[model samples]
Target: QAGPGTIGRIVRVLLAEWNRFGQQVMMDGRVIQRGWRETQRGFDDRVGLFWRYGTGINLDGDDTDHPWSAAFISYTMRTAGVPDHLFPRSRRHSTYIHFAQQNALVNDPDTAFIAHRLEAYAPKVGDLVAYTRSGAANYDRYVNRARYKSHTDIVTYVHHGEIGVIGGNVADSVTLKRLKRGGAGRLIDDSHAWFAVIENRLPLR
Candidate 1:
């Protein structure tokens, strides 16, 4: 498992990228479109870098045929020096989500991430919050390593009844989303069918 410093590094990397993308924020269930988008001039190259680091693909941001949201998460984790064994870079969020689920099932001490039901854990900085987009998506579906459409965001901060998460390809750029915390400090967002929060098990500094 990665140490607390690694988790700190991951959060720093994500915040730095967010700033680079103009510090866009999504609040009150509305998107804030103030920053650079993936297709905009002078910004496509950055998206290309995400693709390169996440998928080893040379595709540019203007190529909308491929969604780069997962790539963005991969890039962030990899750039933060997360080990491939703990957090494998992938083009799909389901890959790491599934991996985390397996780690939870086995209670693997070496795994940096462990998946838990939304009610089971309150997310912390560097943890991942994942949700399903399709009607067929469910927690059991990922146990078999099945391909599914999903999205994940890294938790940047947690406050009273609120949490800040950052994700790539949101509103066509890297964006920060503010979500409400429900009873018992659990995360609740009616906008998406959230299934899991991959807890960061790395020791805190």
Candidate 2:
């Protein structure tokens, strides 16, 4: 197992990568000045992982024909040196989401994750927010990321009434979003298909 300061290390690594991905428009969540075209090609850089450690395609980010959001999240976790057992290296959001769900259900205190409903939790930095972009209310029933089309973002910063998160495949690149929250610092309905936040309990170590 990692030492006491492991979670903080992970958070720092995640935020650094978010910064490398580029700047963001915190008020809304998309990158405005840094050539939105840049978001389109970030995935080509990680195509190797998706290809079983082989080379990635030269495909552009705007190619909605293939979504690399899951790959981007996996790349971040793997790059941060997260233990393979605690997190799955997957190209599907449902895969990791399932891993988190399984652990949460068992109340596995030894692990570093706890999945909660969107309204039940106030996400902090390094935590993951998964969405059912279709606005489906039955999201809780879907046990896997592949069960439906889902997206995820890593919380990088939190400010007044907003949680700043960065994830891949938004607006055709790795984009950051400032998700709105209520007066109590709880996330409000932002009409963006968000369903749950996978709190990184490990960060609290």
Candidate 3:
């Protein structure tokens, strides 16, 4: 079983890492302090996660050719000691977003888990918010793959109706982004960068 406060512990690790090196600067970690949120990939390489998950690809370094946000998420999960079978390791946001939806708490109510529609869900610490760049005119098209590229971030704090998330590869660094909800308590669809938030439920510690 995961230790007491396992979820909190994982979040703490992420927060601590952000505090130490996750600053917003172009190619920040190019010299010293080997870190993940650097211009070059730190220790969190993508090959291990993908290969472990049977992706058959071995990615190396912080190569721009290989986006490392997916690798970053996989690293977080590995550091948290989440089992391989529980999460899908991939470069695309859809790989895990679909899994979270399928395994949402609505389908399995006993576990402390759930996924919610981005426009309708409340921001929670440790929740994941996935966004598509598809420029969807409505909610229906937002989830489709016409435009298809996407990004995902981890929500870390909530206050006064706005939520803060830590995401990798923003402005070329690991940075904290603040998000505002619409008057109806939903994500505003007018934003260019984000379209949806997927809450990946964690088992109670």
Model 2 residue runs over 4 Å out of place are: 26-43, 46-64, 144-146
lDDT of 2 by residue, 1-205 (tens): 5456555666666566556556544344435545243333554453334334211344444445777777777667656657668777666777777778777779878877667777777888788988775557454676544455777888877888888777766665556677897877676746476777888865444
- lDDT of candidate 3 over 1-205, digit per residue (tens): 3445656865875676566554442222132222344444443443344334333457543455766566666666657766556666666666776566556534775433345676678767777777765555333454333235677777777766566676655544556666775666565534345545665456435
| Winner by lDDT between candidate 3 and candidate 2 | 2
Q: How close is candidate 2 to the true structure, as a TM-score?
A: 0.79
Q: What residue pairs clash in candidate 2, if any at all?
A: 29-177, 39-173, 40-61, 94-145
Highest TM-score scorer: 1
Task: Give candidate 3's error at residue 130 in angstroms.
Answer: 1.1
Q: List the residue pairs that clash in candidate 1.
A: none
Task: Evaluate all candidate structures by whole-model CA lDDT and list the values in order.
Answer: 0.86, 0.65, 0.57
How many angstroms is residue 93 displaced in model 2 relative to the true structure, after the best TM-score fit? 0.9
Question: Using alpha carbons, what is the TM-score of model 1?
Answer: 0.94
* Best-to-worst TM-score order: 1, 2, 3
Candidate 3: worst-modelled 10 consecutive residues by lDDT: 25-34
lDDT of 2 at 145: 44
Best lDDT among the predictions, by candidate number: 1
Q: What value does the lDDT take at residue 59 in candidate 3? A: 54
Candidate 3, pairs of clashing residues: 41-62
TM-score of 3: 0.71
Span of ten consecutive residues with least summed lDDT in model 2: 47-56
Q: How does residue 178 of candidate 1 score in lDDT?
A: 94
